[model samples]
Target: MKPSLQLKLSQHLALTPQLQQSIRLLQLSTLELEQELEKYLQENPLLERMEEEYAPPLPGTNDTDSDTAEASVNETDTATSSADDESWLGDEEDSNYQSASSSGSFDDDDGDYQDVQVATTSLREHLTAQLGLMSIPDRDRTLVQCLIEALDDDGYLTQSLEDLAETLPAELEIEPEELQIALNHLQCFEPTGVGARNVAECLALQLETQPADDTQALALNIVRNNLDLLANRDFVKLKKLIECDDEQLRLAQSLIRSLNPRPGSKYAALDARYITPDVVVRKLRGQWTVNVNSDAFPRLRINSLYAQILSKQRGSGLAGQLQEARWLIKNVQQRFDTILRVAQSIVDRQRQFFDHGEVAMRPLVLREIADLLGLHESTISRVTTQKYMATPRGIFELKYFFGSHVATETGGACSATAIRALLKQLIGSEEQKRPLSDS
Candidate 1:
């Protein structure tokens, strides 16, 4: 190979600082944007929020109704502001649940302790606690604990006894029969279905504890073998299988319905997330209209003092900060503007969805909205990623309106969402004695 230097002309797009910021702000969800803004507010002294001030009612508005609503909101804002000033983590509602003050004195008139949220006991912990008091050999207790650890969130043993025995130390000589005994002891523990191998066994374990009767026996047989038939709501097959009348099958099914299918799920940890819709949709004059949610973003502005000082002192160090602040405010506004544009485009395309239900949803895609709005497909993708819109039907992610299409008998197409809605409607409306078939 010859040692040579070659130069080729190439052209590429360069992202300017402002364009980068715009892209970043557009991609962030409403919650993330707020957090990012909080970071900028802390770092830049030249940027500040324009706190909303209460405006007097317009001349002809209902004074009493508006005033009362305004007063309550103001009171809540005042209390929240004070609490935040004291401590950022403090809540205004903490006073109700707080039992003692800083001086260690009770706040309540009665001496009863204020109830606070207690930590949840996981499935393993609950079973182990019950195992502690049992009068059994340590080896048996250890085996029971091992089996308890194997139970899943739904309290079913997904692994077979042979499989589990294989996983144990070979030198210990653990047998499937021994494991079965340990499982029996475990089933005797509270939450009767804790060690069940399947749904049928779980229901059977619970039913075994109840006094045996005609209904109990029939329910047991159904759960043990015909659970699938009952789940499909095939009352006709159920009557023929159980060889009983409608009243008898009805009572047996009622008994089975009262049993919990997932016993350990109650111990699972719960996580609650709150979502703020980015836009709201409403039907106005027989047409769906989209409006950006004002509360989703903060009203921001440059600090007036810093701006005036910078204006007078052109060479001040705050010039860069001022420019950054202006960019932040503009980019945030543009972000919401982009969201409103995309949401309105979606609602316009899927207008039938708003008029009827999900069954009326027409096929749509990002390309359509992108071409219609003269924006890139990637830009529309970012806009609909996590942004939510509130409509009369329910709050839905903006992306929900766009889905894969299914060809219809007519030349047009229908959305997969619409197809699913149709299926659900058909299944729901089918007769209970004879449910709809897949064909």
Candidate 2:
């Protein structure tokens, strides 16, 4: 074979750091973004909360004026920290402070934060607390600890009994039934569905607590035997299998629908983490307005103290430090600019969806917005990934706007969001006693 060289022009996606950050921020839920910001603040030298002005505003203006005057006072005044001139760029002088700062946002004064009410104990905590109330011996308690560790966030025991048994201490041989008993006990906890084996079992656990009726039984049966039918909207076969008329079938469907498929998920178990919406939407005078949720986003500014220190590098031949400082400034600006641009793009494209609701959501894709904003598709994807926008419909991730296209029966293109809305509406209006079943 003769060696040949050919050149062709083709584009392939390459993952750049900035694009990665954009995608990461896009899909991040509110909590994830907070953690990310905390991570960046720990690692970077040039980022900090803007220092408060030393002097009060003009004498005549009351604190109420202070509220309206500062459009950017993100949170309630009570949560604001007193002015700190020193920036948090890991102080090299004190190793302990440096170690503490670099690990994450750890402030000695946690008093500045608002008290966010967390509903339930974490899965491990819930199990451990229950374990304490049990009459098990110390050795068995140790075994129970191992068992609890094997359980996943959804409260289902992800690890097999065999795996857990193997992990147990060789001196104390625990039977599988003993492990089963511990699991059964965990299932009886306040959250109800914590120790389910699967979604079917989870729903069954919840339904068992409800009133004993045909609707409940039929729902249980449908979930156990005809999960496929429920997912596919195959109401005819479901009705035939369950031996119910249209109205009864509808009731059964409604009953089943009301049951949380992932029972342990509500708060006790691990559910999908949702991003905080950056912008809030409200309607006034029949017009929609997008207001940035300034509270969720902390006021980020270039750390002047750090900048001053870097400025002092003029006489010293520390070229690397100067270059690093410049990179930090540029990256910070790019991060904010990208976020703002993506936010604006979302507001522009999803305005109708906000005004009219999900049914009116136009078919959108990452490529469409990427082309509009002169960014790569992946960049748009990342930018929208975990980021949220609070609209009149409630909080939604930015990526919610970029729905897959679904063709309607009337030959028009619709978004998956639109279809979901249609599905919800169909289910909502169907005769509750006899719902439209899959036929």
Q: Which model scores highest in TM-score?
A: 1
Sliding window of 10 residues with minimal summed lDDT for model 1: 67-76
User: Per-residue CA lDDT of candidate 2, range 48-117, in tens?
Assistant: 6554453323212233312211122222112111111112112322332121224433353342231121
lDDT of 1 by residue, 27-135 (tens): 9987798899999999999898886673323222233322111001122132211112323123333332222222243665333232221125777887899999899
Local distance difference test values of all predictions, in order: 0.78, 0.61
**Residue 417 lDDT in candidate 2:** 86
TM-score of each: 0.60, 0.52
Clashing residue pairs found in predicted model 1: none
